[model samples]
Target: MAETATHSGTAVRVYDLHKSYREGAHALEVLHGVNLDIARGDLTLLMGPSGSGKTTLLTIMGLLMKPTSGRVELLGRDVTSLDESALPALRRRHVGFIFQNFNLLGALNAAENVEVVLGLQGVRGRAARKQAMALLDQVGLADRWSHLPDEMSGGEKQRVGVARALASQAELILADEPTGNLDSRTAAQVVDILRHLAHTENRAVLVVTHDLGLQEHADCVVRMRDGTIVEPHDGVAA
Candidate 1:
């Protein structure tokens, strides 16, 4: 697949990113000078083992977490230096995230869950409800809008999460282990939907997962070992 950037040629760009956490008096570095570029109209898989910093990279690109040092550009906008107050609006308009646990509210039905996202984008009332149902339909959850999270299967809930994330029509999608809780068949279906979003909708999709089965469907594959990118066969040295 060509590295097409539907939004001026690049969807999300990260430069020399570093992240650290304090465990007692010791500083544990999670990401070390990680650099990456996600292009529109392609499904990019960020694959690695546990504690490989793939999720850390996803959170940073999704603007949910700040990096210790480095720059992040989304749709050519410099988001690293922006204040916390500015990020919410940016994320609302530009980014959508799909989480491993689905993250759907237990109290809210599928439609309501999706509607909440639309409300943040200034769409509300009957209009938001209608749009949410429509998005749910697109995610293959039609006629199930009134179903609560506990009532649905794991795949169904994740589909609802996908619908919720795309309710605002955000161009950049960051999915972290979206299929982790799903069975193999269900996981493949979810991956198909994500690929459709990237290929047909011209959206940029970054999926952080350890599911090697997904490699066959990726347009571009990025492998991370420890805190950095590496070849698929490269082993981390102690």
Candidate 2:
């Protein structure tokens, strides 16, 4: 596979993906020849019970883990065979991650937290601050920019996480149970922001969760079971 970026608008494509781990003398398979596409401008939900390999698939798609055997294309470039050193830069350039714990710096305020990500993208000093403020405003957290993580509510902190993710201008956003720490109402609000980012900003957002309330907001809901996709959603290849 070539590493050329084609104009396909696809954020990620995995073909015949598989993952396995050696436990004692037995090789335990965690993924079973999975095939999927997470397209740009879509909110895709990966849902299933515990130990279903959802996180395994997500880690591979996010370029955080290598599959046992598969082809992974990100932004139309074949990344499965890239060197480990090369993947960090590529993943940093294209992928933004949202964690369930909100992963904010306890010492930094909202704007500073977001600016930290901009710094990783080589935007620093005044420019990073300005961009961070703009992103906080976009996420409806402009007023909370000066508040520390402990001072903010769970929902507010998650919104800041979203802003930080956007600071990198990432084409693909991988969210792992983004709303797990919030109340129902707050969870819905966060999901709304994710969906809006996908539809309006044309970012491909893939969320791994068992939250049934999020189903209605997703463009496609993919269900996995025992390391394999059991039901593929309509309008999306899985």
lDDT of 2 by residue, 61-171 (tens): 999999999899998899999999999989899999999999999999999999999999799999988999999998999899999999999999999999988888789
Top-TM-score candidate index: 2
Candidate-wise lDDT, in order: 0.85, 0.87
Candidate 2 residue pairs that clash: none
Off by over 4 Å in 1: 1-8, 231-238
In order of listing, the candidates' clash counts read 0, 0
Give residue 28's error in model 1 in angstroms.
2.0
**Looking at candidate 2, what is the lDDT of residue 174?**
97
lDDT, candidate 1, 62-169, per-residue tens = 898999999999998899999999998898889999999999999999999998888887999999988997898888999789999999999999999899878877
16 Cα displacement, candidate 1 (Å): 1.2
For lDDT, the strongest prediction is 2
- The C-alpha RMSD in Å for every predicted model, in order, reads 4.1, 5.0
Residue pairs of candidate 1 with colliding backbone atoms: none
